[model samples]
Target: MLSERQQLILRMIVEDYVHSAEPVGSRTISKRSEVSFSPATIRNEMADLEEMGYLEQPHTSAGRIPSQKGYRFYVDHLLHPFRLTPQELFQLKKIYVDKIDAMERVVQQTAQILSSLTNYTALVLGPQVHENKLKHLQLIPLSDRTAVAIIVTDTGHVENKKVTVPEGISPDEISRFVAILNDKMRDVPLQHVKSKLYSEIMSELNRYMNQFEGVMSLLDQIVEVEQEDRVYLGGTTNILNQPEFRDVEKLRPLLDMLEKNRTVFQLLSQQDTPGIQVRIGLENDLEQLKDCSVITATYHIDGKVAGTVGVLGPTRMEYRRVIGVMQQLTELLSDLLTRLHR
Candidate 1:
């Protein structure tokens, strides 16, 4: 526990360092914060804060900076929820509403808007198909040897891929196969399309003059390809602008880790607790990110978790503002998905 005066001095030091990115001396805090204390009194409080491990002096003559412990305490206790400015809210709403019709575009634009608003790197993990029922499927025949497989999910997500037809397959046969697949596969979750369903569909198709064996294989390939989830990342360049990342050697490995989505996905998905999660400093486990912090929130569809959205920034990030943004963004994303389902 700290005395009231010590707490005030700690808050002043943290706020000063966050703004200027510099160590704060007692005289500077007294002069800048307008605290009702003499320089000597403030210096005594600073010494007490240093003894309590909340502040650290970098050098003999230099001022003090908040330690990681101090930062954690400030985030958990001293911070208040930050409300978005009217201009910021208007910008975010405009971006989201303009692209609501297309799921990919909406998500992409959301990431861009978040990056722009926060001035930090933004990450969005794409929706998983486990809870998304198929809304529509269309097979467009292009030539004797190829066709386009278009799939739409319940959340209005559209996925299309060009597939090569098996040898010796005719256009008439392809159309017939497409019709059979549409009848059996529509309205079912993609993740639930199992090997048993495959066998049953194949058996039914084989009865049609043994013509759809090749078509069945193509359908199998499409289902397999669609099962994998995707992760979208934007604003990596924004990290370079932060003063904490001025050292290129320290920043390179962190940037490299961000490039690899699988590792990030694993890290974010591991946080199973409800509401927003904060992982700070060395707690992130990845050595490259030891000096950074991550703020994440899980977004859902139909009450089931579909994916995660988060911001990555230096440890000196504005926790209150970033947390507020993340909370609102996740809620807005959920509301958008719910409306889409309706």
Candidate 2:
């Protein structure tokens, strides 16, 4: 519980540091801020802030920078929502209106737009389809030993894989199997397909030669291979521009993690909450992200959360602007998804 004067001093220090990316001295704050306080008085308050863990002096001669605690306090209390300009709003609406027709395109373009708007790395995880029902399954014969398996989901996601066919199965037999499987599996939730439908398929297989057992094994492999959700990422170069990450050695692991889709998916999935979540600095579970901050907001369809959209940047990121963009983008994505369902 800081006094009013201390709070004012803290706010000035944080705002100054945010803009300049430099430690804020009492004299600098006194000169730049509207608060009419002597440098000596401001310096005394700053020393107290340092002791209280809200600020830290970077070096012997340097001024004070907001510590992680200071940033947490500022974001929780002092930061106000920043509004976008009319042009910015118009650009966002235009993009949303144009790309809402295709879910893949929407997610991809949303990530790109977020990066462009915020000048930070942006990521969007595709809608989770663990409970998605199978819409159709098709198999195209490539050779006696290999075939292409196509599985379509009710949500319009299509997955394709080249699978090994069992020995001695004719193309005609393979086609028949695909038709039978689709008949039994289409519109059935994938999560329940293994336990509920596997027995039925096995019974059908039993009516054939014992050699057909291999086909059931293939089907089990396909079902067990987890369905991968799509991910869109943009702005890899933006991290290099941030002062905290300017050193390439310090930035490599982060860049590597961003390059892999699974890591990004896991990072976003950690915030399972339904709305906006802000993870600052070491708050992120990933060690590589300890120096970064992530702002995420979930987008929903028919009141069910479908996926997440988020921005990643340095801890000194412009929170108000990024949060504003994320909020607007979340609403835009939700509206687009609703229209898709309709």
Candidate 3:
């Protein structure tokens, strides 16, 4: 707990440091219109705040900067909501209004807009489709021994697999098989498609097609659930523009992690809660991100958590503005995904 004066000084120091990337001095805090205290008094309070672990002195200079503890305190106790400009809100709205029908394109464009607006690395975690229901299925024969299986999900996602046509299965037989499959398996979740096919569809096919075993085996491979989440990143090179990352050595590990999709997916997918989550400095479990901060929010499809989106920047990130952007974007993303799945 801090006195009203101490909290005021701490807030000013954090806001200044975040903007300028430089330590703040007593004169700077005292000069604010809201502060009636003298520089000497403000200095005493700053010293006390430093002793309490809220601020740190980078050198022998008379200035101080907020530590990670100070940032946590500001976010928890002193932070105020940043009202976005009308233009900002309009830019975000234009994305959905333009109507990109595909989920992948919508997600990719969202990530690009986020990074472009904030000038920070942006990540959009693509939906995990393990349980997405199949809207339709089609099998097309290209030759006597080759066929293509197309799977369409209710969420507007498509997956195609090429397989060898069964030795004795004719085109008419294939059409009949697809008709039966559509009747029995439409709307079944992807992860259960193989099981449903084996038990329910297999017996029906065995009576007419002698190659039922081979066809069923191929279907099993087509519908298997993907084990890894997909991660989309935008403005990956933006980190190099930050003052803190001018040195290549300090940026290498983070750049390497970002380049590998799985690492970024694992990092952003750590949040399970419903709203925006802020991890500052050492709070992030990953060592590569200790010098940075991450803000994550989960986006939903049909009222269920489908994926996550995040902004990654140096620990000196603009929390107020970034948090505001993340909140609005996630809400819009949720709405967009719901519409896509419908």
Candidate 4:
């Protein structure tokens, strides 16, 4: 339990360091109107704070910086949420108003806006196909040997891929196969398509089509390909703007981790459970992110968890503002999805 003075001093140092990205001295804090102690008294309290693990003294500096434990304590207790400025709200509103028709575009644009607003890297995971019910399926022949396979989900997501047509399969036969697939798989979640395809849909396909095996294989490819998670990133280079990341060699691993879609997908999806989650410093468990912090907010469609939006920055991040912006955007994203689908 910290004394009121210690708490006040810690909060002031955190706020100052977040703003300036530099160690804070007791004299600098003593000058604040809210601080009533002399620099000598404040220095003693700071030493105590450092001994208690809330502060760290860099080499040769008589100043202190908030340790990860200090940041965690400050965020959980001292942080206060602030409302967005009218200009910030207006910028957010403009994107939704202009791009409401396409949820994917809205998500992509939202990522860009988040990075621009925070000057940090932003990643938005698109709604999972497994959560969406199958809506429609179509096969359009582009040539004798090739066709385009299209799958539409209940959430208005359209996925298409070019596939080679099996020999001896006519355009009429392809249409019939698609008709059968739509009839059996309509309204099924994408994740269950593989099991349902082999267990139930296969026998039905075998009954009418002589080339059922070929059609089944093609449909399997379509369903399997669509299951890959999509991650939209914005301002990946913005990490370069942070003082801690000035060393390109040190920043390489983190940037490399971001480039792996599967890795970023796992990082974001693991925290998609609920609310705004904060992973500070080594709490992320990834060595590449040991000096960083991640704030994630899950966005839903009609109360069902759809995806996540996240901001990644140095551990010295302005937590209150970054958290507030993420929370507001998450709410708006949910509302936009609900209204768009309606």
Candidate 5:
């Protein structure tokens, strides 16, 4: 248990370091009106905090920085949520007021806005494919050799791509497969669609269809579940502006992970349970993010988690403001999705 004075010192140091990206020393903290302690007394407390693992002395400098444990403790206990500023509120509200019809565009814009608002790299994970129900499937013949495959989901997302029609398959065969897919896969979540097809529809296709192998190949192409298509990122290069990331070695790996960590974002979809989630320093699964922190909030459609929106920055992040902004953005995103579907 921390004494009131220790808590006060830790809070001030965290806030100061977040703002300045520099180490915090006891003398700097003693100057605050809220801190009535002498610099020597405060230095002794800081030494104890460092010994307890709440603070770290990065160099020979007599300054201290919060350790991962310190950060976690501060977020869980000392952090207070603050309301968004007027300017921040206006920027977030502007996202919905501007017309956007496509779900992808909405998500992309959400990520962009979140990044600009927080001045940090923003990550927006679009609705998980497995969690969304199949709404409609159609195969429109462009020619005898090719057709456009369109798959619609309950979340109002549509995926369409040109697919090759095997030589032996005719338009009638295409219609039959389309009908079978819609009949069997409608209302089934995307993740289960392929399994259901193999289990229930394959035998029928093989027995009744003229070219069984060709039909199965076409089915495979049609249901190729897009696992990473939904990830939307904004301000990927924003981290370069932070002083902590000035070293190229430290910056490169994190940027690389952000550019291609689809699995990381997919796992973020599972954070459906409410409230802001804070992952500080090594708490993150990716080793690339060993020096960073991620603050995320899950947004939903019709109360089912559709995606996650998050900010990635150095562990010295402005927790109060970033968390407040994320909360508002997630809420607005949910409301926008609900209204779009309705």
Candidate 6:
């Protein structure tokens, strides 16, 4: 365990270095009103800190910077909860006030808001059908033998299916099928929609309709959920703004990882117990992510982990502020998505 004075100094160094992007020296530490230690005494402690592997002295400067170890220690022990300023809170609230309707739009705007506020790359994984409950289903006629079936979920995910309206089946019959299905299956888990449709609703529809089998087949096809693998990204180029990524060689793999959707999905979906996960330098398994930190929060539907939102930046990240932003977004996203179908 570090002494109280040492812990205080480490915290100061991490906080100052994160924003300034420069090495911190004992003289710099001494200038703070809270630090009573002289520069010489602080320098002695700094040398001890470097030996302990908590600090690194760059060859170009007499000042020292926090090593990965120092950052981890600061995050795990010395970091305090950062409260969002009133302006920050307003910016977050504005996302919901915009009243975006589709899940795609909501996730898109969320990615934009996050990257704009933090100036870090943002990734948002939108929930799939299994993570949502059925809100409504409708059919729109396109031609004499064709129609479009649209499925809307509680989380605002939309899936469209093209239906072949049987030669004899009237539009009135199609309308009835939609009404009955909505009445019976409203708010049912999407995975169970097929089972319930086959077992319960099928028998009732058989009496009036002659093409019952074909209509049921069409309904099954319409509800057969497979088209919802979506990821919204923002500020993909923002990493260039960070000092650590200024070199093209250092930025290559990370930029490559961002460009591929499947790889990003895998990265964002690292199932850590739920809520927020903070993976510091080298803690994340990806070779390209060794120097980066990823902070993710799970947004849920009916208390199940449905999707994730994350911010990626260098290890010298603003953990306190970013974590606070994640916490706020988690709650806001949950509320906005949850209230949609209700």
Which number leads on TM-score? 4
Per-residue CA lDDT of candidate 2, range 1-342, in tens?
888888888888887787789888888878864778799999899999999999999876569988888888887888786777899889889988865565666777888999999999998987765556777888877877887888777767677778898787777666666677688888777667766555667677556435576766567655543423577888878888888887889999999999888888888887777878888899999999998989999998888888898899988888878888888888888888767655
Q: Give stretches of model 6 more than 4 Å off.
A: 102-104, 135-150, 161-187, 201-228, 302-304
Inter-residue clash pairs, candidate 5: none
- Give all candidates' CA lDDT scores: 0.77, 0.80, 0.84, 0.86, 0.83, 0.84
Model number with the top lDDT: 4
Candidate 6, residue 178: the lDDT equals 84
Tens digit per residue, CA lDDT, model 4, 1-342: 899999999999999999998899989999999888899999999999999999999998889999999999998989996568999898798878976676666787888988987889998888876666778988888999888888898777788888888788778778888887688889888778767877986777677778877876676767765323578899899999899999989999999999988888888887758799999999997899999999999998888888899999999999989999998889989999877655
lDDT of 1 by residue, 1-342 (tens): 777778778878888887788889878977864588898998888887888888899876569988888888887778776788888778677767875675556666667777877888988776775556667778787887788888787767777888888887777777776676567866778777555356566567676635556766776766654322466777989999999899889999998898787877776776665578888787788898888888888887677777778889988887888888988788888777666656
| All candidates: CA RMSD (Å) | 3.3, 2.8, 3.0, 2.6, 3.5, 4.0
lDDT (Cα) of model 4: 0.86
lDDT of 5 by residue, 165-208 (tens): 88999888878878887887898887787778788777887766
Model 6, 1-342: lDDT tens digits are: 888888888899999999999999999999999999899999988898889989999999999999999999998898775777888788679766766876657777889888887789998887766656788998999997899988888767787878787777787888888888789999888788778877887778886566787677767777776532567898999999999999999999999999888888888877645877888889999999999999898987657676899999999999998888888887888777666635
Clashes of 6: 0
Clash counts for the predictions, in order: 0, 0, 0, 0, 0, 0
**Model 5 compared with the native: what TM-score?**
0.85
**Which window of ten consecutive residues has the lowest lDDT sum in model 2?**
220-229
Look at candidate 2 and give me any clashing residue pairs: none
Off by over 4 Å in 3: 136-150, 160-183, 208-214, 225-229
